[model samples]
Target: MKAGTPDLATLGHRIRHFRGERGLTLDQLGELVGLAGSQLSLIENGKREPKLSTLDALAAALDVQLADLLAREAPSPRAALELELGRAQASPLYQSLGLPPVRPGRGITDETLAAIVGLHRELQRRASEAIATPEEARRANTDLRERMRARDNHLPDIEELAEEQVRASGHRSGALTHREVSVMAERLGFKLIYVDDLPDSTRSITDLANGRIYLPPASIPGGHGLRSMALQAMGHRLLGHQPPASYDEFLWQRLQINYFAAACLMPQEASVAFLSQAKKEKRLAIEDFRDAFGVTHEAAALRFTNLATVHLDMTLHFLRVNGDGALLKGYENDGLPLPTDVTGSIEGQWVCKRWRARRAFEETNRTTENYQYTDTPAGTFWCATQTGRTDATEFSITVGVPFNQAKWFRGRETTVRAESRCPDESCCRRAPDPLAERWAGQAWPSARLHAHVLSPLPSGTFPGVDDAEVYAFLEAHAGK
Candidate 1:
């Protein structure tokens, strides 16, 4: 075969393995299938395509169904689409659909071809529109992230609105008080209700008809947490977003609200000023930023990425990972390499344990920020990580800068160094020979596989929103 050409290397290996498992030589298999040894070998080695009759004969010889011979890793989407289109043109269904027959090496009229393609496109569109999965959600999220990157992750309109709200409330210089946030919601025609038990799947829910925003108690205590939730809920009303039609719209809407909330909590002028001073003094610490603004570490890290990348001429990577090491969220305006699967999602991939983000989970003191120096294929980076635990899981909030840009951060002084060769087995999955000889299987902690990797994403608007509950609530308040 020509180099770099498509071939059935995996199928050839499977055929050889199955043949060996059956304790039969190629000649014996050829004899059973009534084919010469050379022809059978060519088929086994993917040098030639087999006819359906030959495949059926081979299946019978192997005591398996015809479908079993063809089932394996699926082809790419474009390849699969082409294959389906080719099959459809020759199918009886095409004739039933009143479409003209398509013959190989023959040209059809342009109008007829257009009609067939239009019909196929409509069917594929309808199929995609019906159900939503986690994969779909991730794809949607990735798409939105790319859009944001194109704009450098800055939204001037939303930021201006948030800053105006902050300045009007007279809290631009300090943390927005709970009373101030409640009053702001009241002014925006929203009533806030705090509950002790909220569904694990949701942090807050908005009753649009009743103008009531419900929040869980866990989200109520923090100076920033409750306020952020309230602002996000109010933001939807102020921003005039309609009900989302797809998972992509749902994520984009949620992201818009989150950005509005962050901007409200950390106003533009004051935040940029504070960050600028910190950079000049070489005192840019995430915890200090959190304490100064009375926000969570995650919130501070997010705001840092927003402002630093735009105004301060700094590039950074922000990451959030669970204790089990699955990346919950990540972004890099810098050119640092982030691991992504073939579909370009980083959410459920495991982070290298040697990296500060994953290693923070092992610390005895989660409050103390962990710092480390790391070398990656991209370059050397200095990272700062802080851990936060909730009722559900422990998460590490991490911020990292390239080695050249690390001097402005306090964590740059760390002497610790580790190397990461991730997105590969040698990094975390397999052990080095020296460690394998010592304590590889004996004392190493087994990483927990996150279910998000396997869990199907929700179909439709909001994963678990109940239309029936909404109707019931509306009816209950009808007479009130």
Candidate 2:
């Protein structure tokens, strides 16, 4: 009954075992312990926690020590089997099957009990393995996000490394040139090689043996993609990263390389100065930041989050949402409410329809960025969203901050404003009452399933990458 005591079920089973060994009925044991037969039955059935004094009396009457009465282990093999069966039946997974609980009576064979327990365990193991990749990935992402938020998304060590690399490349400029990127790679003892047969799974591959960094021959938009990829390849060597052993390690390494690349491209010293002067003139903007650094809008928006809080004393959020309204990537330290799954991951969740990230796709003007102010349960936030298209789909990149900080941004004068009550079904998830009434039971549309969602995550040391293909590609290129 007290803390650290054996569970009542096991204690009860022990007591019953001792009583049976003594060849005594419940009434006889009750008489010996000065209790009614019904009370003794309850104690034996684990429906009552026997007092210490009662346990002492029963122990004495049953010819055993008190310690024996309260032992943690089940008294017999049948008792252990019964306990296991009871626990398995009580589990959420078993209950979800809607099957009736099987009580282990004297008629049940020990083999039958063992088989059932083994089957349940196998089911549990398979279920855990099936979800382990995504579940653990989400959990890792959530934990990493918390750590990044705690440090304002700034890694001083990586920043220092990037700065040292930029200085060594002699980049003293508005935007890092392809020449500068190539110089940095060469300094890292890697020769940049653009090849037509690069592996599809990799953006860039570093051949450590030959000291060559292989990239695709195709031109990336604005040349920023090529530069970024090359820098990221060099980053592994600069940062001393090894091949990751687990999915979490792989994700962390990927994030580090990305941060390293961005820091090199935007070189904290110049970026902070540019942003400070913009803030001085009350004209801070993602487009200006992108143009100033010659990076993609999404890259600039993400880079802004890295420095905004640490250098500019601002809290902010950045989001990249596809035209379909599914959030692809998101980060926030400004308390801006973003949709998340049960695992606390924002990826693949739907953004509110009224938010600038989703609404930007509706604008007829595809030439410029869209700006809006949205009032939400958290607070009002002003955002600037730029819509862009890739070969596959159109997506929007958004950078936003609380209303108080909006005054320092370039798009503060936008007349567009809206209200949202997200995470609530009534906000944007539910159809209008009139429309629902008109089509409540009449609509039955087939849903288009996302392939990634339908398929299990690809299994490998580096997920989704074919090691055989990579090795073959390396061999083919080795002779070149």
> What's model 2's TM-score?
0.73
* CA RMSD of all predictions: 13.2, 11.9
Per-residue CA lDDT of candidate 1, range 1-480, in tens?
334322453344445555666888989999998988888788765567777687788778877665656655323333333334565665554554686744322265545555666677675564355356667777887888788877677888999989877766656467878877887787777878886544555667787777778786744456577889889988888789887766677778888999999998888888899889989988789998888778988998998888887898888899999888888899887766776777798887788888999888888987768999899877888889999989998899999988988888887788889998776678877978898899855886778775765777543345556545545654664455
Candidates' C-alpha lDDT: 0.76, 0.88
Q: What is the lDDT of residue 427 in candidate 2?
A: 98
State in Å the error of residue 307, model 2: 0.2
Q: In candidate 2, which residue ranges exceed 4 Å CA deviation?
A: 1-132
Question: What lDDT is obtained when candidate 2 is compared to the true structure?
Answer: 0.88
Residue 14, candidate 2: C-alpha displacement in angstroms: 28
Best by lDDT: 2
